[model samples]
Target chain A: MEESNWEPKVIGFLCHWCSYAGADLSGSARLEYPHNIRIIRIPCSGRVDPMFILRALQNGVDGVLVSGCHPGDCHYQSGNFHARRKFAVINRLLKYVGIEPERVQFSWVAASEGPKMAQVIGEFVEGVRKVGPNRLFKDEKKDGE
Target chain B: MENRLKEEAGKLLKEGKVDYIVGYGKGTVNLRTSPLITNKEEDLEGLVINPFIANNLSRYPVELKGRVGIVVKGCDSRSLTSLMQDKKVKREDLIIFGVPCEGVVDLKKLAGQIGAEIDRVTDAEKEGENLTLQVDGSKKTIPFRDVIFDKCYGCEHPTPLEYDMLLGSEVAPNLDIEKSLERIKELEGMDAQERWNYWKEQFSKCIRCYGCRNVCPACFCERCFVDVNMPQWVATYATWQDNLTFQLIRTLHVAGRCSDCGECERACPVGIPLRSLQRKMVEEVKDLFGHEVGIDKDAPPVFSHYEATDPDEFMK
Candidate 1:
């Protein structure tokens, strides 16, 4: 519960073609963002199932970030569009069930949008920081151990 | 209505029309009806059109092969249309007899209202908005709304829209939307953390029986995600954490397909109000996707297709 030692752990599912390249671009351009997120490269945003987000939360991750190509810019053609529809429902369901809106986030970052990627991560990490640590979905029996 | 249904069922069996006639027959227990699956004309004599015909016969025909004649109420027909969209069952193979349902009684609510066990009721007759009952030797009357399931208060179609034959005339939809969605409104009224704690306690009582999954018509997957050990999408134990995860995944899986049949809530042994979560999602799907579950036979499944102009305010 000490303020200095608490850091939010975020899991980012980055699409292979766009968001992953954008992350690489941000690093190449010498932009500094919060190092809170651990990135997982996925084939496309459509491949990110709602189960993945729930599983991440269950594993005690403080937040989940699903980054894909913009609405019309998916490499596989409409994969991001499909992802949008799925995330809309999942996002609403999670909020209705009482999960904080800051815990799970989605965004668009193209390969050229290195500054946008840096900015998005900075904002997301700050939001997760405000929400603090994720103790909600963890297995309670294992806490004392 | 009872005699007409029996006569029609017998005529079909005599004509060698269907391999099975799926309907409800009088159960051995008082005030309970069991599903009747038979090919004989004699079994047609057991058919009863009581308010207690609770089982949704739509899912029963899924495992049965060959031509089938099944009885369906308003909500059940919507479930049948959903199955048809999924290509799970051929519409031509099914000869559906639609029953214009007033509503089915919730025996627990009935017992609670009477301040006695429901088994004491020897006769129940529905006359308009009043329900006449004979409990032991005394006669008591009550309003139908007092003893009906909450889902019935939100019934959109009392008569089946998709049926091969109509057993009765069309009945108008009598909706008490606020009454049906009372539990949902209560959840919505809570702060986020309180809502989470409420569900946490509710799912904690789950015994991992998988009764809700088995009874859902939309959950016809050849293999469920929880069954996979390679990845172990969910732990195969009774921890409240895993149970909550399992239910969350299950609810998302059935978002646009579930017709709010209320079978899952009835099947739950621990008395979890599973319908609260499901019914909430049903309204969410309609608001976001502009799609109502199983209402249109020609429409595609919600998740399988996407619109270019879908809501994306949730995304950054």
Candidate 2:
């Protein structure tokens, strides 16, 4: 890369029951991971509407990561499963319309899997860095760049 | 078939069986039809089922409060079935008149082929498989397949699957889905940037008219997300970015529910290829869930119910 220090700004939506707690556990353990991600705690990944991801992209976030309980381990019986259906459709659709697939990622991170969460973030940020900035909705008129 | 439909509609109104008869009548313009909604017995004579009846009447029954007798072609019936599946319309509350359709003519193709405006054509008569057009004292003939709507190419249901009375004999589907989806495959063949730019250019022409939303039978939201300004989901302005946002959100919103009716594309005034996005989603939903929309009236909506073994390769 030109600058060699340009880190990607990624937004992580973590479910309160699993992925959020996993982030907490990673912090407690003093894990070594990239600080490029800003986490938003949600009740469940099922609550992450497809609009939220699109808004993040439109708002110019470099990447978006949605993490929740593993299938069948949802806090609300079938929340993750429902979320999976939406994710499947949205991911395919977003990429079909030419958004970089690496810009959005979905993962499962249980409370006990703190190391995995750190590693997931590390890998996701690296992938985002490869894809470069989010220019999908760049408003040249407003930005005046 | 037209006589039988008129007689049955007359009987329905005369016997107070339905509160309204939703069908099509000859529009003032040549080679066009407007939705004909009426409760009077005299209007039955105005009902004309022809090759030019293109508008899907399924969206009407959802709003009409009382008992309704609506006419349906293949795609319109599927849309009705989808609305019924969602409990938006009750079966007992309405009577359905099924018209066995070969395929409706596409006016845009006709205009382009004849190198003239659709309104200029004085008369269009269907003779078996060819259309004889009388344009300014000149008679020109064209095959029916060359001018039919793209959705009609692969229509799976040429007759209503669940109708009280059959207007005519059931016809076979042409099964030329590839012919309709040619544009979609072209888009997919492009690289990410090219595809994005293609849609950007298409959406830039959008004037923010909600014609696509209004005509879509699946877009039956009472309070659409776009109308709500509390959170200000999408900006009201007609900026190209917001237009893209509006269509992207709309396409996602009607993912499984969309029957690929092509009404949204047909309704676009600026000639955006909206059917490509919708038809692509149809392909994805079909591949992802093996679920064809509006096929069965009893099953739960595609997203409401999920299989335990659903594809999870995309997720971590």
Q: lDDT tens digits, residues B1-316, model 1?
A: 8898899888888898888999999988788898999998988999988898888889877889988999999999999999988888888889999999988998889899888887898888888888999988799999998888899999998888799998888989999999999999999999999999998999999999999999898888879998999999898988888899899999999999988889999889999999998898889999999999878888898988999899998899
Interface RMSD, prediction 2: 0.8
For each candidate, what TM-score against the reference? Answer: 0.97, 0.98
Candidate DockQ values, in order, are 0.88, 0.83
Clashes of each: 0, 0
lDDT of 1 at A107: 98
True contacts kept of each: 0.87, 0.75
Name the TM-score of candidate 1. 0.97
Where is model 2 chain A poorest over a 10-residue stretch in terms of lDDT? A136-145
DockQ of candidate model 2: 0.83
Per-residue CA lDDT of model 2 for A69-113, tens digit only, reads 999999899999999999999999998999999999999999999
Q: What lDDT tens digits, residue by residue, belong to model 2 across residues B13-47?
A: 99999999999998989889999999999988999
Candidate 1 ranges with C-alpha deviation above 4 Å: A1-3, A139-145
What lDDT, from 0 to 1, does candidate 2 have?
A: 0.91
